[model samples]
Target: PAAPANSGPLTRPQPVSLGMNAPAGPPTWFVCGAAGAGLGPADSYDVVVRIAHPESVYDLDLYGGTTDPDEAAAILAEALVGDLADPHPGSDSRRSTTVLAQLLGPFKAVHGRFPSVPELRQLLDGAAGPLAALRKALTATGHESLLRELDARERQMGHPGDVGAVLADRIALLDRPAFAGFFDTSGQSRPFSLKALDHPVRVRIDLPERGHADASRILARLVLAQFTASVTVRDDRSLFACLLLDDATGVVTPEAVRAVQRLRSANAGVALTLRTLDDVPRPLRGPLLGATGCRMAFSGLTPWDGQDFAEVWGKEWTEARDVTDRQIIAETPAGKAFTVVRRVITGKAPTARAVTVRQVERERWSASELAHGVPAGHAVLSLTTVKGEHAPPLLVDLRGGPRV
Candidate 1:
């Protein structure tokens, strides 16, 4: 018998809380006893991992740049860093000084050293001159102010307040290693190079964890790695380029999403490892998932995350039922059937007989099941296709040697 129905608060079972599954063990890796085989640059991939700890030196060279979502990210490695912020290379007053330094590089190469303003102008006049196209584009873009600023910076390159001089000085300070040079083939540090490719050299850079991390610089380097790989991969499909980023705290910009969309065609890939989905911004959750086609979710995803994944996998027809009445029959003293009532109950209570049961339809794989059911070793693998059909999800074991 059930307790008396009351107007008091109803008692219910405690809600279930998911457990955090510990990793199986340390990662498996073996030392190479034989002579080291270097990875070719053309077949190389650059991976960046960020952790929430002491910052690394590689982060110092970060330069955050952006592009419209409707537009693809573009990078001209041979171009100056100022170009990162503008599609029209020399169109920003803020980067006038930086632009002059670019022209100065070639000017110095042509002559024995730095050229005069007249010499630089003469260089810009050539039919195939880089600055000619830039200036022409500036006029087309209605950036008269930028052109004026460029003229001002060129004339004041040697002045203390000169934009070009200031930019050149800043560049000198910023250019420490190959990390700053996007197109630099001879990346001075092996730790900062790509892993392996069919090219002559590969580079890898591990951020140091000994000091306070620079948020802006770290973000810059991450964008650089992601954008550079994405750009080069498109130009050269024969090369294998990738970025393995760990602790990607702030990589979810429109540019990053666009990069993911564009990378597939370029034969480049960027892999990021984050602590939790909560670490990412809310607006980007769908895009992040959509960009990643093949996904394996471990145990203990939050209810929201589970719901998101559940929705992706979709709903299905499942068996369910409802209760109507309860009826029981018995013979009393070998005569006939009799009914007995032990306790009085509410209107929905079953009669003192057979328990009531009815068939009803319900959806399967409720959000809670995904958020809490599976054990530590097992994971749900859901594959999403471009055509929008989700393959039936599969359960997998992380440490299992192989699936025969």
Candidate 2:
């Protein structure tokens, strides 16, 4: 049934609580933005997750504002389907053919300028059989159009001297399989290096589970490769990864994990989101947690999660109890409002650890609750300082014109 006309706007009821054993790996950071702030109409949210360890480092952003829910979902689905089907086993074969064709064009043009027709015929005959037939067809016609066509075809076939040899060299060098082997042997072309780019900033978009996985993966690789290469070649700067994740329920696949791991290994900064701690995948729990040092928790109704947070604070305060306790008394008009106070720890001391756990609550939107045009809920923005000193801006200005 359709929702009632007077029904209130949609809103997340409350966050689910997590247990103490909430995955021991990397910290899984999450954010649930309001409709316009970070979440979009396509049932998507922007997220950023970063992981840094002593041996390895990873930074990734799962959601970029530009990707729509449909597009993202489609990419996810396509990746899954493609992996299962394993289509196009020899797609790289075409690259060799293309390089060969390119080499042929210049070769023919150079040979075509020969002083004698016999020399030209000899050169053509010495080439492939199809090339020789093509030359004959052109000579027999003598028409300017046919000659021009033949010349063009010959040039495309390649330059005269060792054209085939040069093609072989390039094929061995540029072919994907060969290239992979070279990298494997040389150790310079690891999976991390394959996707590395030279960009100061890289924007990544994480799609919802319903979106196309393949398309999203392609889009991400293209954007990252283009930006990284352009920035590196043009500016000679190291590549940086800026990412966003839009998973309402933080269920990610093994492929996603591997892809993200590759990105992080390249020293890219990442940002991602999840609806709750439980939504995080079991396998990814450790790496995700270890990567993200900064965290933000919004309003949650789950008692267990709240209690877990309370315990963290309790441990921090354990040392404070040992210190000299101070007492204070307060008087009220209604009655004797007496209160006892103790010295509160503030720095890196054991007692102060618990104080770091901040209490955050969800915010409500102020616009008309029943307005047809208004977005669902009010957005809450939280910033975490991960690897860098500066945090990216989180603006919520609707009047800034449409986003491309």
How many collisions per candidate?
A: 29, 66
lDDT of 1 by residue, 114-198 (tens): 4332333343333245455545655676666556644553465445433444333333332334223331222232223222233
Residue 176 CA error for candidate 2 (Å)? 29
**Structural similarity to truth (TM-score) of each candidate:** 0.48, 0.28
The residue-level lDDT of candidate 2 at 121 comes to 28
Q: Write the per-residue lDDT of candidate 2 for residues 1-404, one digit (tens) a residue.
A: 01111111222111111112223222222222221233223222222211111121223221111123332222222222212211332123233233333323333443432112122223333456645665565566554554564465456454544233332332222223211222121122221221233322222232222223333333343233322222223242233433333332322433344445454334443344554545554445555543443332333213433233232222221222223433333356332321212223322222222223334432132112112222332122223443344332122222244321
TM-score of 2: 0.28
Candidate 1's clash total is 29
Report every candidate's CA lDDT: 0.40, 0.31
Q: List RMSD in Å for every model shown.
A: 14.8, 21.6
